[model samples]
Target chain A: MAERVMAEAVFDDLIHPSTRLSIVALLASADWADFAFVRDRLGLSDSALSKQFATLEDAGYVHIERPVTQHRRRVRVRLTDTGRRAFVGHVAALQEVISTAKLGARSD
Target chain B: MNGQVSESEARLALDAVEARRQQVAAEIDVPGWYWWSVAAGWVVLGALATFAPVWASAVGTVGFGALHAAVAPRVISGRRGSSRLSVRRDLVSRRVPFLVLGFLVAMVALTTAIALVLDADAARHPALLASGIVAALVVTGGPLLMSWVRRRAVRRLSA
Candidate 1:
């Protein structure tokens, strides 16, 4: 698959919150993650994780799927292309912030 | 968000991101069962060579090879090591399957060498003894190989 080029140094408000940033960072390394896996990994309660997922879903940053299996229903979460781009850009922006501060410190 | 956040906070967030990436990197492994099964199969093949007829031994080796071929493709990528998530291919080395296959081939050579040494010493059941030794290696060395893979993943992520 052809990956879209990430935008440069663009800060994203929707994803900047610590909780959401952690979620996105985890998902960025996976193709799809089980809800329980994300919840347990982040040490968040189901309701709390659901609330965060709902927010990200509304922002079109993530796609949630309920796959029916013989055992039970599973919620699988995937980062959307837009979300990946936003995340990549947000990380770049964070690095830029640090570098600019370093430059200012060097000048001073 | 960037405007209000201080440099130290950005650094911290970046650190957190790296931590999460490392967590995913840790997940890059073959399941524990895969190693056990391979080890068990190796021992079984060794047993067959020791006691079974020539045709039976040949068939057992071929059948074992077939089973391994079927299963290796799915697990060798080190992506689906857990039921929780399928790791992104970019997070794993493309050389994973090659590394695993290379390790197995080396094990085969080791087994042969051990068996030959034992046979020269006029030891009983040389094939069985050799296979048992290598099976132990498979169970132990397999996890070590994956740990090495995980370290490589962490290093690449940090880079």
Candidate 2:
């Protein structure tokens, strides 16, 4: 399938790290995900997941909400619009890198 | 340009992104309880049709329909199969609920036809027999339908 080449292909340094990238990529496909679910799915410890979430939250790329339900509080995470844009831009940037290298090899 | 990353590394990153999307796509399903409940209700309605008074059977059918209507909105998208996450609306087909409902409607029609044939052949408890057959199909076929949905979601993501 052809890649979706966005007009703005900005490489986001904050989201380039492997762990953060995985988290963002997962969130990109979900409206909102439970904190525990994300942690379990990625095989990360609570502390480790919290640390990553804090980094994303500080960057305005993710929002954390603690909602009360059934007399219990649950943590849910969703990517902000800014974060979604950054992720899309980052993916486009990655695709560009590959395509540019392929073009260079073909020219040679 | 991401000068620090080589072409192979960029490719790997993109692959990882796709993998994550596939993981979410895999979650496209209705909860197991939804199937079980529907199957049980079908059998009960069938039993009512066979042995109960006509009014009782009518009420049972109406009750089942009302219950399904109440619950379908939340589960029919095959998005909240798990409480962990709700699949993004754009990622799932909007017609999934309709597909499920349509499948049920077809089953109802099939049951009526089967019962008619059984009665014509002088079989006893035709309604019960027909409902049992359709209920079995519902229990087994529901999950298969959701699996097809998940595969479609993955294919859409890959595309």
Q: Best candidate, DockQ-wise?
A: 2
Give residue B67's error in model 2 in angstroms.
3.0
Error of 1 at B118 (Å): 2.1
Name every residue pair that clashes in candidate 1.
none
A44, model 2: CA deviation in Å?
1.2
Each candidate's interface RMSD (Å, one decimal) is 2.8, 2.2
| Docking quality class, candidate 1 | medium
Q: What is the C-alpha RMSD of each candidate to the true structure, in Å?
A: 2.5, 2.3
True-structure lDDT of candidate 1: 0.91
Q: List runs of model 2 lying over 4 Å from the truth.
A: A1-7
lDDT of 2 by residue, B9-50 (tens): 899999889888889889999998898899899889989999
Per-residue CA lDDT of candidate 2, range A1-108, in tens? 222323378899999899999999999889999998889889999999999999999999999999998998999999988898899888888988999999999999
Two-chain DockQ for model 1: 0.60
Task: Compute the lDDT of residue B141 as modeled in candidate 1.
Answer: 99
